[model samples]
Target: MVSLIRSALLLAAVASVALVGQASAECETIYVRREVRDLADEEWRVFVEAVQKVMKTEKPQEADGQAMTIYDDLVKQHLDYQDKCHGTPIFLPWHRAFLKTFELELQKAVPGVVAPYWHWGFDSQAPHHSEVLSHKYYGGAGQGEQSCVPDTPFKDYKPTYTADGMPKCICRQYDDNGNRIAPFSPIEELASIVENSPDFDDFSSRIEGNPHGLVHNGIGYGFSSMSSPSDPIFFAHHAFVDMLWAKFQERE
Candidate 1:
């Protein structure tokens, strides 16, 4: 009986050590990405400030010493890669990689900063009026025929490059025929897309077609074209799309 008890105790100690090792491995692999709504006001402020800093900081000196900020680099990247990244089989993964890299850049400025995602489905009923567009956030609708944004953090933002490779003020066109742009696809619609899609290609295609394209059209101007990243909301919108893809992945 004594020998049996000692064996049992030794086995228990070994099991405990193994369990601790397993937990340490799991901790090393696990990471958390938060949604836009989940972020506190302070967290959002930090993210926004980091992005603004990137926008102001110029790129490395070249032959011509181009006055390109990190923000300009991102815009140029999107403009250059839009054709390869959009409406293709690799669309979702490409954007996912872009957002991750962009988040890393943001974190370099403000440690622990994660890009926040906008849940457009939640505001599908009244996307234009959503708090995301409030003066406290991305600002209200565009003003005048050119649809130039008037009262937002980016109102004074002048990009060095656009789809046309020309300097222009950041702009948004939010209406047509005296009506607000169409609302984003609701959660129900997304649910259907996930359920009906048989593979990653089909799933991503559906997402890009509906919620993705609709949001761009709804925002108009820079957002409606390859120069979408020129608008800060572009990241938030794409992050939410990535979140939805993750949601679908969870079921698999």
Candidate 2:
């Protein structure tokens, strides 16, 4: 009877292990993120609305003894963790978490709204003409002396938690009289970035230096600043970078 009981217990343990493995395997779910310009009309509307909603919706996060909006919190997270992100080995992973957090916050505003990416590679040759800069989207380079965004859905949107902790309009200063759109990382360069790197270090540096930097610099001053999250395009740009990192991982 004792031997029989021992055999029964062993069988139960094995069964439990098998069940856990099955659950783990089934837990994998793939979410496809579409590019901004490729979103369906309804999807585009929802994405834009969700972004605007998140920027204005206040949450219970700590901020100088005042509640801050989801946008504020997201910006603060990036600004505070700048050390862990820029010019570091953790740049890719750090921004992945940042993008996911931003996505979750956006979904809270509009269920099923996915954070769209800007395929800078597609716009590498002529970024100014990319749908990403259209009036319907994030807007183009700033117009006048102040370099404030001329017009867009977010033209008047203000981010209060900027570098000076004061409200400010989004601005971009494309160098050389609006002619400096940094070509970004072309399609071929993107392919090389993912497939040619010898190790994680090389991959991280190459990505951060090119596609990422090129996009930020191309976007202009406000985006190049530490308070880049102030610009809605910042999320889309990072999303693309995050996607690139994922592709590299898959290749590995």
Candidate 3:
């Protein structure tokens, strides 16, 4: 059992209630997670604005002597405990709950909004062409010294931590020359991987590797670190991952 203790200090006084108080005792409320492209302009605005707001909001407690944003604190949790969560069956359940915590924290700015999914499969043919990589969303690959992304709203953000501990920028190293991001695993391949698995372990192992790695490797060089949550897209990317698991459950 991976210890939940790793995250026990996460806004414990503020989020403890959100984590438990909002549980539907009888399972009555159904929340919808929308695809990023499908969101209405206003809905997209709300989501983006909320993310920016939380990026600036302080955590109740300083986790690293420096007062980090709620976003970075979440990142630190992964840095502190990724070994227990990834490359194991627990990855699925651990991230599922972790995503929930992210959504609740986001609610601090946009009460009703949940994370959105990136259906990268649609852009599999040419990932650099993805609007998500354009200034419209998270912005394209980094440029210049440190490859600091200079287009996304986060361009100005100096996240407190990184694997190198010095980027001071969310650095995505997409060569962006049509080849940096190889074609994503085909959607049918992803669905098939999920659909063909006969049981939990089978499904979890298959889904966690290919397409999962595709999402991370294809575009998030900035995120393969202890401070990955510093990039807001991490949660959305995982939201789509979680949806695939939900699809498998419904299929079974």
Candidate 4:
């Protein structure tokens, strides 16, 4: 009887081990989005390529009275929902969802692609001089009247929608009164705002008021308008904003 009992106990233990192993194998690993600064040159290349693909690919279905590219649809969505999504309780959550959707779309174009956050805190000191503004990257400061964007991957690329209700080339103006617009709010400033806010409402207000507003305004021209998402950097900028909110959540 003792020998039979030992055999039964050993069989149960083996079955348990097998079940645990199977469960472990079936679990999916979750991926965390990284900062744009952390992306390698090759990774940045892949991301840029994916963005271009989405920009050039036309949407198969006309949802809002026109056939548009995936990129144009995103711009239109932002324009349509701007009032509901900005400066309200839904602001953070709405943007978070939007970022996730955009990231997924990007992945569909380029497998394993993830949207990267721009840590503007690091670039706040001298944003106009930041490497992200290089000709090899998003492009340099605008030139000529109207502050038209020049010499970048997107210089010649025109968007289907604009703030004025017409199609136009990507436009940006980094200068104001003969000097680059003020540097964006630094990380230290952002930390102070997040740490001081007593609730979600205050936190959202403070964030939208400063760094968020500062970055958009500093970029000037197209970036300053309601259709700001037309600029590719808009995604990276907002991703960091979302990260800041996540940081605030952790502390609370």
lDDT of 1 by residue, 1-252 (tens): 133234434543442343344343444433466766677888778878988877787888557877788888788777767776788766776677677667777877887777888888889877887888777777667677666677767766778777663237667777454237677788899888877778666787899997789998887777787877878888989998988877766556
Where does model 3 exceed 4 Å of error? Answer: 1-25, 62-64, 175-179
Worst 10-residue lDDT window, candidate 4: 1-10
Off by over 4 Å in 4: 1-29, 63-65, 165-167
What lDDT would candidate 3 get against the real structure? 0.74
Instruction: Flag clash pairs in model 2.
Output: none
Provide the clashing-pair count of each candidate structure. 1, 0, 0, 0
- For residues 1-252, could you state the per-residue lDDT of candidate 2 as single tens digits? 133234434543442343343344453545679998888888888888898899889887564576778887778777776765688766766677677778888888997788899888888987887877878788888877667887767776777767653337888877545745757779999999899987667888998996788788877787887889989899899898888877876664
lDDT of 4 by residue, 78-164 (tens): 787788778766677666767766787898899889888878788898888777777767776677766667766766557887898
Clashing pairs in 1: 36-117
The lDDT of each candidate is 0.74, 0.77, 0.74, 0.76
Q: Which structure is stronger by lDDT: 2 or 3?
A: 2
Off by over 4 Å in 1: 1-31, 62-65, 165-167
Total colliding residue pairs, candidate 3: 0
For residue 222, model 1's alpha carbon misses the true position, in angstroms, by 1.1
TM-score of every model versus the real structure = 0.83, 0.85, 0.85, 0.84
